[model samples]
Target: MTWFLISIAALIGGYFIYGTFVEKVFGINEKLATPAHAQNDGVDYVPMSTPKVYLVQLLNIAGVGPIFGPIMGALYGPAALLWIVIGCVFAGAVHDYFSGMLSVRNNGASVPTITGRYLGNGAKHFMNIFAIILLLLVGVVFVSAPAGMLTNLANEQGGLEISKTTMVVAIFAYYIIATIVPVDKIIGRFYPLFGALLIFMSVGLITAVGFSSEHTIMGGYAISDMFTNLNPNDMPLWPALFITIACGAISGFHATQSPLMARCMKNEKNGRFVFYGAMIGEGVIAIIWCTLALSFFGSVDALSDAVHNGGPGNVVYSSSFGLLGTFGGILAFLGVVILPITSGDTAFRSSRLILAEYFNMEQKSLNKRLLMAVPLFVIGAILTQVDFGIIWRYFGFANQSTATIMLWTAAAYLLRHNKLHWICTVPAVFMTTVCIAFIMNNATLGFGLPMTISTTIGIVSALAITAYVVKVSKGKGDTELADEEKPKSAPETV
Candidate 1:
């Protein structure tokens, strides 16, 4: 309980301290016109209230990642609490704030376009393909998971009897509408309500945990036990815990989603609240759900057993419905069903904007919007037919891989500007090593080499990249700056 409280306080306190410091470093200039005001298309680039933008951005990034990832990561023990608090305060929130502000400063360019400017044209092209693929996987997976859950819920209730196929079609229809319409129309209006549900669910769980007399649920294995993996499966703490808890910690997907809000923000000052503050809010939510999962089951062993018996979704269902009864059922429905559906729609929406920016196509007209969206949704619909497990496994890898790119790109941007480049550079190097280690050590992809060899390679690769970055920064500072801001034009040789 002490560990949990400390983690909660750290996340909250982080916003005022580290979050504010980051805001200062970025130097928000409210007098400057944002992309929303500079290019108000009404369709995509529409200014919104800061609160609305914050809520949308929070829900957009949160989705199922923070909740589900932490639940699984909890199997590794309380190491998750440490990661959520530390990573959210430093790496994840900083990554998000910089991503959003950089986009706002550069006319709401997508992550790939931004990467092209700071990294190079070659890196940019690669990120373009990677971001699109990751987004499609996210859209398809979020769509299938929620639709299947909703179908099951309906079946269990013995009521309206919506088939999984029908739910997919209905959900996809909502996605299409959300994608094609103006930013302020469907998304702006409905997301606040969905955001309310998300917050309420967390509040309910936190209250239940706080008031409960069952210390057994909260006892056993202090937070320090998390330093070593306690999983019965003996999963490595390095890459497995990092990837499993991506949202609560750090995720490249948030960088992609940041531009969506960047285009809608009314002030640069709001970047701190919308991007950094939202990540902290997500950390709080993750802490609530993670602690609740452990407390509800009375032990990490029981929680792991529940996860093995069904999946994260079953754990979500059991914890919510089983604990809170009918109220819990409603919260479970929102967690297992509604939240992912919201994220799924926005995933497609972000994909549309990304493709538009990539092709230098105008999206002011409905025809142009449909032209970009139709093929994407068609592909997403087709992907929905694929196995969810395969898509999820690939997504976990792809998500962190994307984050590694964003961190390095951000580091490069800072280096070119002669700011404290290490802010982004250090985390970038660490995550680069993690990504390499994951690919080299995972059972499916590599030889499943010994940890010693994998760690050695990871360290060497990370140092090599960091040294290259430092070497490049000195000679090409001005050249890099010239390329950093111009997204549509081909990048200058650095």
Candidate 2:
């Protein structure tokens, strides 16, 4: 499932790039272009090629969540892969693509702004509140997962307790660089190189595990045995699956990425490539991580032991690096550190943009800094204390709920415009149904109803938003709608 998804994502990413450059040939005029507003002269608003945007999007979306979520989700047997792939293509990617394209068309507005435009002021308010809640949940879980990874690395490599202070310092340093560096330059020069190294390391690790003579089982029983034999007291399938998808599937963080990248697009026609394209890439990465986990560990029982006795990061490192020699293990460790830095940078920048827009503050102003500091500090403190595995589950659920709502909004918009066929509506429908099913499963299995409750509320909100958008589209004929804004023409080479 992991390899299949990654392959699809890579193809989509490539297609999106090709499509972006060919927009003129497609007769997509300036009228359909993404509008630019509140443009930043700094790092956030730099215009980048479709490929670069895709890389940033991929890096931002592919983080520790995918690694942990699928490994844990595997406890439900291979049955869980059904939800991950279905959700990724339909619910997850669709929500990301459309939300991004819509935001671009509306002057790089965040999801809340787009929701307000089509849904109504009330829907906007609800979406904003929901988005923020979801963001915090995501931040908390992501933060802890990486920190735990580092702790485990320190324990294994040095046989010493890793200080929270060292982790905090490392995080702070990464964020400082992320804030100062230009994303375009980073993507163009470093992203692909870094990506290549990571892939090579991953391939090496996967090869090692495949050839190992230790504990081999026939007909995939080794994988199945891992799940069936897990400690009975651990969280059960229904809730675990829900949590897994939530962390790995569609997330609110994508909402932030969509709008930021939308502003970089040269025209509206690039939407299919940039928005949908990057999502497919992310799905593929998720697949790779999943495959690595299953093939390397051979059982959920082994994975759980690593997490409990050694730590989750140990499970990851031991699995990926254990296959390689000491050098390979160290490489895996560095990659893990780099992964979070890339993701954290994107998240922080997006969070800053969203907060600045919401409060109508200057991007670099002291007020914006003050507003962001509290959330960042609070999130950091939470990471220092919480059990990341549980937090990841919550984050996954909240993210899927948000994606479910966004998909409904996109579907309604497309249907109203009679562009439903062009849009990826099939994926949208699948995501919505699966998310609801997972939510229902969670409820029946006695997981606290918080995530399910949020999802249920999102379903209601999506319905209301869709109805409102349709009503508005009817009132103002589609032909009368304003043209989407476009960027100024690029200068010709001398």
Candidate 3:
């Protein structure tokens, strides 16, 4: 209970303290015209109020990441609390802010295009393909997870039964339509509704956990207990925890989603509120769910048993029902069902935009959008037949890996401008370490190397990248970095 309360305090306090410092360092200028005003198309690039943009940004990034990831992460003990709080404020929020602000400054270019501008085409091309694949994986995972959940609920209730394949078809169809539609049509308008439900769920869970005497305060591991790995599998806390806990802490995928809102932001000053603020909000949600899982289950062993018996989805449902009853079940439905659908659609939309930006294809028309999306959705649908567990494992590695690349891009942008590059460079180096260690130590991906060997490789990789980035920065004057030309807007593919 004490740790939970302090984690909550950290999120709120970080926004006012560190968030403000970051806002100032990024040098927000309200007077500066954002891409929304500079490049409004009445479609994807229309300006929106800060609040609406904040909601969309929040929902887009939140998905099942904070809820589901942290539930699983809770298995690692109270250490999840440390990572979500500290990681969100320092690493995650910082990553989101730089990525969003960079897009706003660069004509709302996708991360890939921005990477291309700062790094070379080689890096840009790799990121472009990597990001799209990651987004597609996200789309597929979200669709399957929700569809499977709905199927379970139908079976349990014995009403309105639906096959998983049918749910997949319906969800993918929605993704295709959402992808091709303009921003204001489906996503911009309805995202707030979803955002409200998400907030309600977060608040509901937090309230339930706080009020329940049976909640078993400090049920699992305390802060002191966190120093050792309590994971049932003895999963090392280093790479596994960081990678598993990405969204609540920091995710590379947020960089892709930021450009969607970046196109709609009317002023540069709103970037902090929209990007940094949303990440902190997500951290709060993650903390709530993780707390509920730990408190309601009464012990780490109990929580693990619940997870093993019914999976993470069951953890959510049983915890919610156990606390708030029927309404809690509704919240569980929202978290388990609706949240992923919202993110899944946007993932596809972002992919469309990235592809359009990459080929310099204008997205003002439906044909151009569909041309990019049809094949993408088909591939996503095909992926639904494959086991979701495998897809998600790859997705975790890919998601953080993409974030590592974006951090490098952000670091390069800061260096070229001769601004303080350490903010991004340091986190970039750390995540660089995390990604490498996870890749090397995982039995599925690597040779099941010892954590010691993996840690050494991770450290070396991080130091090498840092040295190279610094060396490249030293060779070029600030003017040279600034003079790296931005891409010209592509001709409208009418």
Best candidate (score: TM-score): 3
Best by lDDT: 3
Estimate, for each residue in 1-494, the C-alpha lDDT of model 1 and write its tens digit.
Answer: 77788888999999999899888776676666788777778888888888999999988888788888889888877877888898888899999988898898788999999888777898889999999999999899788888877786777655776789998999899999998999889888989988888877888766766776653345777656868677867777887788888888898889899999999988777889999999999899888777777677877788888989878887877777766677677665665476677778888888998899888999999999999999999999999999888888788889988998888887877777778877788888888888888878887866588777887888899889887666655555676455434334221211
Q: Distance (Å) between predicted and true CA of 67, model 2?
A: 0.9
lDDT, residue 383, model 1: 93
Mind giving the per-residue lDDT tens digits that candidate 2 earns over 385-447? 666555555566667666756765665566555554234344444455545646655654333
Using TM-score, rank the candidates from best to worst.
3, 1, 2
Cα lDDT of model 2 overall? 0.58
Residue lDDT tens for model 3, 1-494: 78888999999999999999888776765655677877889878988888999999998898778887898898988888888998899888999998899888788899998888777788899999999999999998899888887787777655776888887888888887888888888888898887777777778777777778777556555567756677887777888999888889989889899998998887777788899999999899889888887788877788899989877788887877778777567665666578789889999989988988877899898888889888888898888888877988888889899888888887887787677777788889889999998888889977689889998999999999887777765645455434323323332211
Ranking by lDDT: 3, 1, 2
Candidate 1 shows a clash count of: 0
- Give the C-alpha miss distance for residue 318 in model 2, angstroms: 1.6
Model 3 misplaced stretches (Cα beyond 4 Å): 217-220, 475-494
* Model 1: lDDT to the true structure: 0.82
Q: Alpha-carbon error at 344 in model 3, in Å? A: 0.6
Which 10 consecutive positions of candidate 1 have the poorest summed lDDT?
A: 485-494
